[model samples]
Target chain A: MRKKPIPGLSLLLAVLLVAEGCAPRIPGLERTSTTEAAAVRADDEDTWLKAHYRDGRVAIFDSWQVLQRTVEGDGVLLGADRDTLAVGPFVVPLDSFVLFETDRLTPGRSAPGLAVMTVVIGVVGFLCALNPKACFGSCPTFYAGGDGDEHLVAEGFSSSVTPTLEATDLDALWRVRPVDGVVVLQMKNEALETHAIRHADLLAVPRGPGERVLADGAGAFRAVSGLNPPAAGIAAEGDIAELLRAPDAKERTSLADSFDLATREVIDLRFDAPATGDLGLVVRSRQSLMSTYLFYHALSLLGAEAGSCLALLERGGMGGAQSLLQPSEALGFIEVQLPDGAGGWRTVGEVGETGPLALNVHLLPLPAGCDASRVRLRLTKGHWRLDWVALATLGEAREAVRLPPSAALRDGFDDPETLDTLRDPDHVLAALPGDAVSLVYELPPGDGDWELFLEARGWYLEWMRQEWLGSPDLAAASRLLGDPAGSLRRLAPAYKSVESGMEEIFWGSRYVRAAR
Target chain B: MSARRASIAAAAAALVLGGCAGAPGPRGYLSTAPEVVHTARGGWVKVVRSSADATFGSQLVVEGELLAAGADTLHVLTGTGPLTVVRAPRDRVTLVGLHNRAGERALASLGLSILSLSNGWYSVITMPLNWLVGIVESHTQSRVGVLEIRDGPWDACRTHARFPQGMPPGLDPQRLTLHWYWPSAPRGFSTPR
Candidate 1:
């Protein structure tokens, strides 16, 4: 007797067929040897380990070696130890290292657990789909503050404010409030504490201007727009003044017909210096196009000049030996000098290799113990046109400003205008002290389902230590704060009935709102 | 079950199985099978023409169909004309049959469309997933094949001679030559079963 066909058999068959179809197939005629396959598998294994394991965390083991004998460290496993296992600074040969033991954080081993959790969640989701209301009540929808006078105080409040002011000191407490559709900080200080500072006033803090001197023909040095070429065998000292008087021309020859100098020919530029601050010279130069074009086309052009040009190009055009001479190679350097108190010119720095068709600022540092009052610039090598020279005061030596361990609490403040001002790094540096500052999003009353999210923006461990919030684990910290629902929870008590949806709902690093 | 209902179910099952079976695996000049070449009588064939001289490199790939199969030479109809026959020496030329799955390509296109429809809005999450799947799928399949030329042009005899209607647009006959080549026959060039 023929048996009755099972229901859904066709569907099952279809699924099986699909699975079989999608199953990876080995090419019929292709021969993948055991060695090749093993090599490929080893490569894949190494790749997986590298991707999942944090640097220096994986343990390396040799053949017949136990886990205890494995070399464990916190650096990344570079690759399979064919010769040596390169884990950062440490390297162990393949004869000694064979196997890899993944760290706790490695996703490969933990993937099975995650997959199981995903399946469990999927099953729960299927059940929920059949009986939605039984699994969860109406999903709470949160809205920002509308037109209302009732202000709900933001929870998890911590402030940098303290009453440590002297009798004459102005102790102030700042808080942002939406006024006339603009978020302005209301400052509470000793004299006029209740006044609200304008958003513009809070935003615009005056920045210290940089110390720079623009030397445009108006300086103490004789500014020459153009100069004539020096006569042959002219003294280096005389040629220096002649070049200084020459116009800022593209080609070295155009400034003065025969500007090319013999070895050690010095073009001295003198300028009066300032009394204080470290002085630096900036030379604005223009590189010629002919030098580059000639350099590249030297081989094609047949002549002694072409040969010399080609040689120069190979030896890094005109200035110094660079890698390659491109069409944009208009670069040259000049030795800077300041009087060495010992009655001689002291070489401070060399500046050049300016960009093509653009003003290149070459900063020349002054020599140690040199007299800035007698600052001078001397061109010793390569032909280049100088536009103008500026004396800039280098930044003074000051203690490095260290950013304090800070945490930016991102509540439901989606106000871009206000948030931009609040989150500005410059504004934070200027306004707040090295203490915690709360950016409270004062919502309208009756909106009970508000979720709070805490973001450890920078230096999380240090911030946690400072706050005495115990471990960096979000769930543990939330539990310590009398929050039973954990870091990922909903504000409403009705939503707290189901913890299965918590992973999906609280996707990122967030604090679950405590049930009221 | 009733006859009509069983027929409907059977039809549905057949349709799905047909879709899966007809799905095109992958397409490339090197990956073409000999069976495909035999069946593609009037269809286009990509021919890699090697030079008789060893010093001068005159290797080129041309798209044509078999015009007349001789004992030693293959008269192929090239882009120039039917009269402009390319006398490809049987020993010097390699012929590969191209088979592109239209249905499988449609399915893949549909799958990509669905993925794009869902993930286009949330690209941050979907983009990575899409890339990962793509990488995995690409590594799993053989997209390109290596053409292995043999001593005799007897392989051309297995392929029938027929005049093709016209060449497909955007098909560059000259540029279709395989990037990789060997002086002699390479492995995995056995006659298709």
Candidate 2:
């Protein structure tokens, strides 16, 4: 009877065989954290395995070899001291691959691994069996007939010979190679881990396809998947052929404007805080344009934390109510005893709505408001990106309103809506503290000798991490952030300290030893 | 059911039960094995809920030391004795050394001084022999009181006469302590409500 080929049976059989050939899951090998877990497997017999942990540590045990099964739900019983050791249930984290080695089998002694000679012959014969059309033109036995064909002819060979042809020379065609009990497994931080026992003296050789990991082999090996995954794919990189492209002037301008704005915003929040008075009024009125820009940006980042103009005016420390009265506004004045004796009162300026948040500051000549001189600015637009700062006579009380702790802590992560709400300066200022305490939550001593104080309603005070008896210059600060030789250099001066709810940047300390 | 059917059913049930077996257990990594142990003791884990309650308060105070004198400015550290130092036009002459704290007795060794002569040129002097000498002599329409030493005779520092009682105009550090009394326990940090 002529053989009739079955349509889908082969495909179904192939899938079943592949599925059955996979390893089984191992148990108790999972990674457990505050958030996640993992497991591993073996595939010969239907059993479970458990990793042993004692006294909060993973137990290291003597190794015993057992045959690994290549069928689902099968577990191998690894005996220890004439008794069954812990059984593990292995489940590979989905979308992960495990590379492993199998034992080599030999003639007469049925070793667990596949025989090299047998594999060679099996591969050649399989190709021939699958493609009968290639051999149909010739007889079963062959004598040198096709051009210079060697050896006994196919016509003379027996029909049961199976006609083997080993392609040993084609190393490129081979995917699996012999390995000696070694394997490397890689899993992501976001995924599960797998388990595989390691022998004392086994070493692995590289073979197979996707992302192979070779082991150094010493103990029972288990590779738990990491919680994070490897990047899915690589992005394209490399120089491309030049192609002429030009945009319209209008479009270009728009793009340029957008880019400029972005850069400005970034610089504003990152480098500067905000000012309390008009941009030109603070810092001895001697601030540069760049500093002014930075100051405004910092103000934007502060959101509502920045105070109103009127509040700035009322600050007696600036000069007193008299200095703020537009040189004509009548003021209530009083002078008490000063430490040095014989002090006077004078108002500088005041600007704002009459409410508590209003800003009014009295300005003295150069050094009167020195402590509160520099105006710091933060990014009030597009999330909490602190980019710029300016030093003005008035400090950052008005500009720091953008990134107040309460609102910053509540903004949604990675959301654009949160970014949108942070852009408006008025809203930013509103978030700022009306008084001093809100601006300064905590102040800790620095490096033993340096003392840090929060300048009430002052930008420098707000960002003060630790101030040494002697202040370090701006260049020294830059060195601290840029130097790689020391950890202090690499240490970020600014961070929201969890213990104290304050956004702080470290200012230089006094060199006590130098002073001594 | 037939015996064969029962055997098959038994295998199916075993498979189901086995699938659910070995649910993940607590982990032991790093030095401390998180609070998972307390949570895992209960079989068939249950999700716990969280809650929070708020209590309001009056006011808060921040304390720190004042450093050095600035140009046209005088900083007073007021945590100790003789907290108030009255400045007079005669440079260093302290008008009235109100030592009422030490049973109305003033420290004879304590004296006041003026270092610089600025825009408001007026003769500056110090009275070493007596405490109330400068208060009776210095003639100035306005006086700048710098609260210097904070610790001392409490009675003298807290004396109502030393302060005009209505000076700074806004919040009286001596009287109007709003005393904010809010609970600091963060929201959603407690057991289920």
Candidate 3:
């Protein structure tokens, strides 16, 4: 948890690389001459011999033997008058040759790149200074080999920042079409944080034709058939026609009010109540990273005590709810409200979970005998990106078959016991920045439709940046971690200072983009 | 692992992989004068000639279009001496090599390598590695014939000669460009075991 602060180490290294690349490429300047005895002693089949004559003639031999007075070898006589003339089996007197030499390594291609870089670098100069303050964001990034090249499938437990806040996160491995009986999930820690993954289990349920298995707010899987879009959906801006019509990334969001991030906004949708089975309000949405920024800023406020402060949360140092997770909790869920059919709107249930990187789909099951014709969704302004909102007809709850990872590998080295560790709640597969583990899961071979949900239980620790140091706010830290609504109101302007750049900075973590 | 250890490993990987980028791949060569007949894929030849001094600075070089090579003899044509023939003898010949150019690529690589310095501490390792890759890629590659550099009664060299069938029936050496088999030139690349 404790890291030493290094100053100017980054700048020094950048300058050093520029210098190495900037060095002059003088032709044959790298060639170092050796004595005849040194060349003979080090000579072998792999050795190449160079004969320098007093008459200014030079030749290279592929193989040679030194006689009492004559050097007899087979190789080429480099003649300027023609192609390097090949010669051999003939004896050249030691007296005729001024020096005999050999080189172990070829001066690989003299990089023309160095010369070009030197000029370009000389002109551009140092553009980025070595800033030790790094942008912070991390989670176990999972790639199902489906999310385009750059897009990640899911980031595990994006909200779980500490041991106390560690919770089992469920993510639908969206867009994955499993081939054969295998599903390989590449779990990567692409940030400056340590991930302690307790377990990664593939929870799957049979999905019949035209039927989708979705989890409710309480993590209960429901078979929802005929998910119909709202007859009409309207938000603060206008009709939510193109945006919230489907689970596309095309989302509907309102800007944060100038004064408060907690300002509330609602979208009303009219749906034709399915007179048959139980109904559920299906909402697929994700947080806006505003909460993530607040969390990091709060940690920065803690400064030197960041580690100790987190340890306190883990050890119950700051009592009550988790201070780090409080802002997210204050923003609350996407609360669904349906008309009582008596002029007032009554609460139905809530949908959505935390995580700004991936979309969360939840079935907020409507209470029996309730009118599902009209619904209103209430949420904090700019706090969420709603991708889809629909009314689904729910069926019976189905039991799931858990498929645990059969093997875990990193760089081709197998660690099969990682399977057992993933099962045990007490153990964790720890991953540092740049570390990656492939979790291989084998399912029963079948053509039947099955939806896979990743149940990743873990937590992570963000490595503090130097920019976070020197500022310590104890009372404010407590208020932020425990009471977000109150502190959010006071910290509004401060949050605004970084609101515009936070998302870009958080996503563009230096460690995350490291060469894979 | 500590961030320091992870960073160290990353740097090490960068160096090893970077060195590999410019590593002599299958010794590919591009001929600038493709129209001319050449024994090797590339006909350009550089002969490093060293005096008794043997110092790098004391060395001079003769570079020209390769003509032909026979057993213990090399013939080259030079444009600098007003389209003359050069007959370089084995005794005066030093190191001989055929070369290629990767100047443009090397320069571009250097530019990008310098730009990567913005990556903070990572630049220290990446910068030099980038430059190395560029240079390695821009190598003066060795060809098959050059790789097997030994006494040549080479069929290709003989065929590429102005007098492939050993001097013509009525052609005179003085009338045609004088065949300079052994000229005042240079040496070979040396290696330790």
Under CAPRI classification, how is model 1 graded?
Answer: incorrect
What interface RMSD does candidate 3 have? 13.6
Each model's C-alpha lDDT? 0.30, 0.19, 0.60
Give one digit per residue, the lDDT tens place, for model 1 in A1-516: 999888568765664455455433322221111111123223222222111111112223221212233322233332211112444433333224222322111111111221222233344445434222222211110112322221111111011111111011110111123333222221111110111111111111111333222221111111121111222212343433333332232223222112222123354454443435455555655332223222222222223343343255345444322322222122235666666668787776776542222233345555444455444545423235454454545543222112211222323333444445545544321222112222333332342221121111110000111122222333332232233223112222322233224223312101111100
**Top-TM-score structure, candidate number:** 3
Pairwise TM-score winner, candidates 2 and 3: 3
lDDT of 3 by residue, A149-238 (tens): 434566788777887677898887666667787888878786667899999999878888988998886888999888888877888888
The alpha-carbon root-mean-square deviation between model 1 and the true structure, to one decimal in Å, is 32.9
Interface root mean square deviation per prediction? 23.1, 46.3, 13.6
Docking quality (DockQ) of candidate 2: 0.00
Sorted on TM-score, best first, the list reads 3, 1, 2
Sorting all predicted structures by DockQ, with the top scorer first, yields: 3, 1, 2
The docking quality of candidate 3, as DockQ, is 0.08
Better of 1 and 2 by DockQ: 1
Identify the candidate with maximal DockQ. 3
**TM-score of each model, in listed order:** 0.23, 0.13, 0.59
Q: Which of the CAPRI classes, incorrect, acceptable, medium or high, describes model 3?
A: incorrect
